[model samples]
Target chain A: DARVTQTPRHKVTEMGQEVTMRCQPILGHNTVFWYRQTMMQGLELLAYFRNRAPLDDSGMPKDRFSAEMPDATLATLKIQPSEPRDSAVYFCASGSPRTGLMNTEAFFGQGTRLTVV
Target chain B: EDKVVQSPLSLVVHEGDTVTLNCSYEVTNFRSLLWYKQEKKAPTFLFMLTSSGIEKKSGRLSSILDKKELFSILNITATQTGDSAVYLCAVEGGGGSNYKLTFGKGTLLTVNP
Candidate 1:
């Protein structure tokens, strides 16, 4: 089946360490989104890209978090000098918007669970 | 900011029972509302409602939206243990947010046999 792929289903890191999550979106989808989920914050949109170009990343912390789509197929989210508050499940979703609107039918990958101690 | 709120943060029911999950939103320039079911892994697409008062159905699951009230409801009849999952509601559309999705804190459903 054509599904979004994520690497390292689980990751544990020490404080001040770096963590990177990779995602391979389903072929042919033109939009990719990165989200972080936590018990307190629920689901928060960190960043999103359309046609391999970033459209918005206002939700991400510029100092520590960065997201990029190197190509049409691969997207990455990185946290440099990760902190405990960054522990959460990060998800990657992709879809093709219908006409001029944002995609309502989005597909998500099995999230990457990160923990920092 | 566009916002979505789901009711009854969690619910528990027995097999064969009928249940309804609620989702309310406040978004500018509304385009569409979508529902998803998430198990232990990724969330899977369930339904997308664009028009007001139109119902979308598949198997034992169905959903309807209300543009006037800016809300939607998902109904599952004759629930099974396999239906135990988190139901998510997402809305797309807002000023400068046409390419972004705003999600709710899904409702967790637990069905026991």
Candidate 2:
């Protein structure tokens, strides 16, 4: 079946290390998004891309977090010098191009649970 | 700021019982409200409500939206163990931006046999 796919379903790292997570959006879809879910923050959008280009990333911390879609099928979110507070399940979602006021429904990946010591 | 809130953070019910999940939101340039069922892996799309007061149904699962009150409700009749999962509510905005969804904390449902 068609679905978004994420890599390294689980990850553990020490503080001050770098972490990278990858996502493969559904074939033919153009938009990709990265979100972090936690008990206190619920779900927060870190970044989104439209047609392999970065659209908005205001929710991401410039110092340590970065997201990119180097190609149409692949999107990646990376954290440099990760901190203990960065522990949470990171999800990658994909949507189609905007159609009128509504866009294609977003499909989520299995998500990668990260734990930083 | 856009925000979505889901009530009754959790619910417990037995088989054949009915339950209702509520979600309220405040968002600018409202587009649509969507419901998702998250089990073990990813969240799966359940329903998307746009028009107010129109009940959308699928088998035993149904949902309705209230645009005036900025809220929605999901109703599941005859709860089964398979229905035990976290239900999520999200709101999509119509602004020019690519489209950001404001999601609620989700309501966890537990069904006993």
How well is each residue in B4-112 modelled by candidate 2, as lDDT tens digits? Answer: 9998999999999999999999998888899999988788999988899999999999999999989999999999999999999999874686567778999999999
Which ranges in model 1 have alpha carbons more than 4 Å from their true place? Answer: A99-103, B95-97
Task: Specify the poorest-scoring 10-residue window by lDDT in model 1 chain B.
Answer: B92-101
Candidate 1 fraction of reference contacts recovered: 0.75
**Per-residue CA lDDT of candidate 2, range A75-94, in tens?**
99999989999999999999
Give one digit per residue, the lDDT tens place, for model 1 in A1-117: 999999889999999999999999999989899999997778899999988889889999999999999899899999998999999999999988667755457899999999999
Q: What class would a CAPRI assessor give candidate 2's docking? A: medium
Q: What TM-score fits each model? A: 0.95, 0.95
Residue pairs in collision within model 2: none
Question: Positional deviation of B42 in candidate 2, in angstroms?
Answer: 1.0
CA shift of B108, model 2, Å: 0.8
Error of 1 at A107 (Å): 0.4
